[model samples]
Target: MRVGRALPLAAAGVVALALALTGCTGTGSHADAPSPTQTAWTEAPTDSPAPTPGATAFVSSGTAAQNQPVFDAAIRKVLAKNAEADGNAVVAALKAAGFPMNATQVSQSTTSANLKPGSIMVGVKVGDSCLVGQWGAAVDGYQSTVAPVLGSGGCLIGGIPVVG
Candidate 1:
C-alpha cells in the first residue's frame, strides 16, 4: 500500500515538472512563442501587396506600374525643394510617409562631387522586390526591380555614372 501511494505521487510530480518546463500552463499567448529567423525584408505589414515578380533582377515593372512613379514623384519633390538633401534626409522623408525603416536602404555619395547636389539612392524592399529612387547632380529617376534587402549603389539603369 505504501509503495502504491508513493508511485502515484511521484508520477504526479513528474507530470507537473513536464508541464512547467513546456510552458503549457496558460501563462502566455502563442504570440509570445519564439519565432523563426526573420530578416528585415519579412517585417512588412500583413496587408501589403505581394512583391511583384522579377523585382530583384533589375527588370522594370513597365509603364503601368503606379507605385514606382508615386514614390519617385515624392522623392523628386523633396529633392526639387532641397537639392542638397543627403541620404539621411531622404530616408527621413520616406519613413514619415509610412515606409518601413527595416525594409529600406539609403546610400549617399561619398565624393565631394556627389555630396550636396551630389547623389542619394533610396531602396525600399517589398518581399523580394525593390523600388529604388535616385536624385542628385548626376541622376534623377526611379527603378523597380528585384534587389537585395540592403541594396547598394545608385540602382541606376546603366549603373552609377561617372559624376564629377
Candidate 2:
C-alpha cells in the first residue's frame, strides 16, 4: 500500500536528519583546542577616578535654583568619564549625585529612525521645579537649567522616567 511504502521513507528521512544534527554538537569547544585570542579592554572602562571629597554636594532640601549647579556639575562629571554616554547614564549620574530616581526623566537616546540623536534630555524634579538638560551626540557640551515643572508634572515633554 502507498501508506506502508511512505512510512519506511519517512523513517529513513528522520534517521538522516538525526545524523545531520549530530554534526552541530562538534561546534562546542574542546579542551585540546586553543583558547580565544587575547582581548584588549576595548569597551568603555568602568573604573572612574576617586571623587574629590565634598565635591559638588547636592542640596537635598534646597529649591531647584539652589540645586541646579549641583545637577549640572554631576552630569558634567559623568560625561567626563564617557562622552558618548546614553540617556540612562546621564540619569544614573544624577541619581548618584543624590537626585531621587522617581523624580527624574531622561529622553530616548536614539531617534525613531534608529539613529543617534543630536542630544537627549535629562531631568530631575526638585519640589515644584524641574532641573532639565540636554547632552551627548552632536551636543557641544551642554548647560542645564532649572524651570517650573510642566503640566505633566515632569521636566521633559515625552520621556521615560528614571525609575522606569
Candidate 3:
C-alpha cells in the first residue's frame, strides 16, 4: 500500500514539475510586455514634438563637430519629453533613439545617501564628441538644456558619477 501511495505522489510531483517548467518558458503573458528598447518610446506622450527635420544630420557622422545644433536639438527633444523621468528612463530614450548604450551615462548629485531632487544629466559620447543634456529642479522649468560637451564636461556638471 505504501508503494502504491508513493507511486501516485511521485507521479503528481512530476506533473507539477512539468507544469512549472513550462511556465518558466518565456512564452507566457510577460512575453507581451514591451522590451527596454520599446518601452521608452511607448511611455513617451503621444503628442511629444518631433525632432527637427535637420536632426538626422547630427547622427549621420556620429560626431559632435559635424552639426552641434542638430545634435543639441535632438537631445533637447528627448529630454523635454522625459524631463520628469528618472535616469533609467532617460537612458532608455537615448538608447531607443540609436545612441549606443555603452556610450551613454546618467548622473545625479545628492547631499545624503538618499537621492536628492537635484540636477540630472544624460551624456552620450559619439566618436570624439559628446552630447550633453541637463534637466532638474535646479533648472528653471521642465525644459532640458542640451549642448556639445564643454571644457568642464558640458553634461557632466556634478561629477556625481553615472548611475545608469
- Which of the numbered candidates is closest to the native, going by highest TM-score? 2
Pairs with backbone N, CA or C atoms under 3 Å apart (clashes), candidate 3: 150-154
The lDDT values for all models are: 0.55, 0.78, 0.58
Using TM-score as the yardstick, the better of models 2 and 3 is: 2
Candidate 2 lDDT, 1-164, residue by residue in tens: 99999999999999999999998779766988887885642332234232344457666666666677778788888788987788888777787778888888889988899998988888888877888888865668776877778999888989788774
Judge candidate 1 at residue 39 and give its lDDT: 73
Model 1, residue 122: displacement in angstroms? 1.0
Residue 142's lDDT within candidate 1 is 36
Question: Against the true structure, candidate 3 has what lDDT?
Answer: 0.58
For every model shown, what is its TM-score relative to the native structure? 0.43, 0.62, 0.46
What is the C-alpha lDDT profile of model 3 across 1-164, one tens digit per residue?
A: 89989999999999999999987886757667877665422332334343455655335343444434554555566667765666666565565566666656667534467776676676766555576666677875444333456576434655433433
Q: Which regions of candidate 1 deviate over 4 angstroms?
A: 1-66, 112-118, 140-164
Report the candidate with higher TM-score, 1 versus 2. 2
